[model samples]
Target: MRPFYCLTFICLSFAAAAQGVDPAITERPPSAAQLPGVDAPPGPAPRPTPPAARPSPAPSAESSSPLPDKDPASRVERLDALFADLKRASTSATADRTVDKIQAEWAASGSATADLMLIWAGEAVTDKRNGAAFDFLDQAILMKPDFAEAWNRRATLNYIASDYGKSLADIERTLQLEPRHFGALMGLGAILEATDRKAQALEAYVRVLEIYPTLKGAQDAVGRLSEELAGQRI
Candidate 1:
């Protein structure tokens, strides 16, 4: 039972509950301070991202083509456009849809072999076979080192395995490959909070909010941390 196993269990339980399944949220261990670290940042307020232009109604003919062709650069540009839309989304529902579109772009690796390996790795993670999942993900990265999605998936599995340091490292790599990755930014915030680096954790959450303002968790987290830090000054 790895340390991340408990966190994974809690997350799965939450997902189940969200789907109207009657599972309870699992409690973390006393030492599981990292889970709350995401809510402890006390640093100077992070600058909000400047608002981008509101997206025009997407062309109907191209709505079906969410995934880009084999051109990695083109795919990145596609993702960038989606992220821009997400940042400017006027409604939470719109932001949610944009996030899904971004994720869809990330899922297509442009290489059949790497994509297959990613599926295997995802299944392994579901099965709680962290070592096996890690191996598959590593192979995927080897097959397509520039695949930001593969690195992000491995970072998630590493977080679940409680290899926080490795998870953070992979997240950094993921961001280097795709800077607008809100998922990686959120993970980095969580790890920072767990390590008692509350200020940095807050900054990470702030970044996530900037990328996706309708993200409820980050919204609550920013509120909570802001109050906590303000109290300390009293």
Candidate 2:
């Protein structure tokens, strides 16, 4: 089986009332794994939006340039070091830099073509070109089934256009490749919360916090869920 590595970089976003688009199809999306069809809470589903760019397309082979390989041994060592720095960071500002460094490490797929396709797919998603994005991502995954980022990305698109089952499948594949993927875990948590699996959702968020304690979003989710769950048990 192909081994992949995924980071839990996604979360459920309850789009603020002010965040709506004009009555037209446009924009990006997010994650979760409490598969669909559960008694999920009544709310907008999580969507798949492109993550922050790692420099920036399905791109032509001729146009692609060689990228440095993320040699597993070296990259893992670096990530371990970075995670340590991230947790020790005293401020969000300081931790943010470490967070970016870790994600940059995670984004490298060794294959320039796959990277290009991922960039193209992100652009397509941003431009409301879901079909194009799908094509780009599909080609990327075909080319690199071991690409954890690719699987995580497809999971986002699957949830947006298809169903939770398909998205979760991709997510699980990502985790299979990289169990430390906090981003995938965040996606799982969000989906669980949406699907009315509050206990499971809390567990997921706690897992994320274990990886990145400075993440305010996870802290917020944990706090919110704790109160809600406590009330239920009361």
Candidate 3:
């Protein structure tokens, strides 16, 4: 139950954020200091990304559709444009392409070491080696505190591990770093819905739509939560 609550918290938070873009209302996310291994000393220094792990970035719509600059500010600009394109996307194929580009941008964490670490973490997850994934993600975050996707990945890990408290914290941080993250928003909505926070969940799913109007899951969540809440009111 608690674990579900954690995922739901992330989902609800995300959905709500999707509806609103409020940077002023901040929530603490999982930081290195807050998770289990603050004092455990750093993991091994990141090695060169394994050939297979350094998989290609998500496919881009054009060879040069967005910014190629790698600074945080430039990443923001690139994401801003992709998000705009995402909002205007009329078909699922267009939306997915834009989403892939956005994910690719998230994967580019400035620090080559951190990026490689993230790739390793992703591979670990695929291999069902969550412990390894956690270690890699932790190190990645350690190296690049501003890498929102690392936090988001950890959030999913926490959710899968039934560590909702940590997952929710990670979700909060992910949103703080990148508020327009619909994936995180979806997680927040799931947590809220799981915990019976219907009104909040409804609000969250609604917001997700604001950012990504074509999202079928958020749309379904909104529809159901709205009907349920309305029935309760009646």
Arrange candidates by lDDT, highest first: which order?
Answer: 3, 1, 2
Q: Candidate 3 deviates by what RMSD?
A: 10.7
Off by over 4 Å in 3: 1-46, 49-68
| Model 2: CA > 4 A from native | 1-70
- Cα-based lDDT at residue 192, candidate 2: 74
The reply for model 1, stretches above 4 Å from the true place, is 1-68
Residues 20-80 of candidate 1 have per-residue lDDT tens digits of 2311111210111122101111333122355698976767886655544866678768877
lDDT of 2 by residue, 1-234 (tens): 001111222311111101211000011012332221011112432234666878445667864754424356777788789888976988777866775566556556767777666666655555566677677778878988897777776766666663667777887887787666666666666667767889887877777677667666677778888999999999
Model number with the top lDDT: 3
Looking at candidate 3, the ten consecutive residues that score lowest on lDDT are 30-39
Which tens-of-lDDT digit does each residue in 31-77 have in candidate 3? 11111101122455445544665656876777445455745577778
Q: Please give me the total number of clashing residue pairs in predicted model 2.
A: 16
Question: Deviation in angstroms for 132 in model 3?
Answer: 0.8
> Which candidate gets the maximum TM-score versus the true structure?
3
- The whole-model lDDT of each prediction reads 0.58, 0.57, 0.60
What would you estimate as the lDDT of candidate 1? 0.58
